[model samples]
Target: MAEFMTETEQSSPVVPHPGTTGERRGRAGGSDAGPYDGQEAAALLERTRTLVDPELRAALESLPGSLRRIALYHFGWQHADGTPARDNAGKAIRPALVLAAAAALGGPTAQAAAVRAAVAIELVHNFTLLHDDVMDRDTSRRHRPTVWSVFGDADAILAGDALQALALRLLAEDPHPASAPAAARLADCVVELCAGQHADTDMERRAPDEVTLDEVLAMSEAKTGALLGCACALGALYAGAGDEDVAALDGFGRQAGLAFQLIDDVIGIWGDPRHTGKPAGADLASRKKSLPVVAALSSGAPAAAELAALYAEPYVSGDAEGVVRTALAVERAGGRDWAQTEAADRMARAVQELSRAVPAPEAADGLLALAEFVTRRTG
Candidate 1:
């Protein structure tokens, strides 16, 4: 079977595919490969939303009219017209990570206590999404018009800013000792995310050849990995874990986040529009210097020149053939293979870090399944 399977297929993300880089590296080592139920990850995510929604909804409700409307719309809880809509918040991956990490280390008690922290982390994630959509000028999210597209850019930006404030406030009002540190860590992550976003915009202006693999990797870590790491670490903190174990959990989340980004980039170029809710070749149309694109440019293969030429010229609207050729160039230049292999390797490392904290495979199943699901989904 192909690694890039259909988005609708039932995939066993818990186990690395045979002969893949993760399998060769023994993803979680010998004892870490127990009976992992992929369905548990989904259940955990659903449960996380159940536990965190009320608090999250209350926080959003606290916002004044304009900001509240935008925030609520952005979160999928309300329609553009401010009427109630079916709950459509995203997958709740980050919050699930927080809760799962807590459960892995300290069992159900810790998981219950960490609900507020999970909500805070979710708020931060959505805050970034709102801002990112505006900065990227993306027109859609969750199959609906983006905040910036529906409401003006200024409103979207203000809503994003409000979300960040709300996240910190949730932590501040909590009496839990972990709340203080979690707040500080989340604040730091916001700074790093902003810096990473700046670097991303800056990279887009530069020549493709000028951006290095290391630079893009660093930016990915800052923008995506940092928050994930903080999520896991906050969970550990709430569990009363020592610093070392907390750091290990953070490392696990960071590595898994990088793997998730790798797959996400691949999907950006080739994912099905039916599932991704975006036009095909959207990344190519935007001339995004995604990890694969950068890797391909760095390769010395003849296709590198072809890809460079394709990237050098701005993509004209409706240039389907051009997008196909550019995607082919990236593949022939070894970008696709490299990114997949790299993602598996990152997963292997993530499992290693996870094992350091939660040695038992059964205990770590939730985190592992969530990590795999994020990395395995083609859309």
Candidate 2:
């Protein structure tokens, strides 16, 4: 059994993923076998896209025409010229977790029962991204121009709002017995996401000293963890799971989401831009208070103090050397090591949480594979 850990303990030397200036990065140990081995993960993702994309596309059609076009285009369903495009879109991880959880608890036959839950979660996930792209002023996502960058901010925001409403309406209109509680859970997730985003933006505007590690963790759990938890919980609900099972699945996804966020913060700093679909050091360049940055600031090392000095002023957008040095300073301050350790620990706990809901290892292979995909990344 994994112990519940609330503090970070650390060690490591890491490199960026391959094709980023020809430097190859790997995890600390040899590869482990599972359904989620990268190749299989891609296949699982494709299978999920085939399963969920039709229903997801159908939801877009229920929107107002102009808003629907913008949303569809944002989803990589259409090109800027309003023609069909075959590009892959969002990662589809959330919806996959929902179906995987349902399958784990109630077997493959429960997949159809979980469709409404899957669609609702996926819609809410995209809605968050649409709004996030606008707020973050991100120019690109999935290597395509962001919705706000392409369609203008107001229209993008309107489309996002429409999607959120449509997600709830899907549940409310569905005849499934679990729809009402699932809808309530999704609504709660949206509220928490908003609160988390508010906390994040609020932190950015204040001094680095003003934020606490606990505060950042709380904000992260709300921002990234809440929806993931809802996605998993909705599946159990659809499977007609007991309260204990639902709660366990929720905990599994929540802890894994937190672990995923920790790795994401590391990627935001050191990950290859080619694989991540964003500029390297984008977070540092923006001076955003991401978890690693916050953790570094909270550390008491002299390097931490220096990093705090760097954050004392606004980051110049084009200062590559500054970004590189900031990343180095963060690592020296033990920020990177702490995040990696925390992520691994959380992932183990997440698996433990899964065992509570589905005791048989074979039953949880799919969900375990998904959880491993979160932490055991090469890029």
* Native-referenced Cα lDDT, model 2: 0.78
Q: Model 2 reaches what TM-score against the true structure?
A: 0.88
* Residue 313 miss distance in model 1 (angstroms): 1.6
RMSDs, each prediction? 4.5, 6.9
**So what's the TM-score on candidate 1?**
0.91
Instruction: Give per-residue lDDT, candidate 1, residue 76.
Output: 92
Model 1 scores a C-alpha lDDT of 0.82
Worst 10 residues of 2 by lDDT: 1-10
lDDT of 1 at 296: 94
Name the runs in model 2 displaced over 4 angstroms: 1-35, 274-277, 316-318
For every model shown, what is its TM-score relative to the native structure?
0.91, 0.88
- Each model's lDDT: 0.82, 0.78
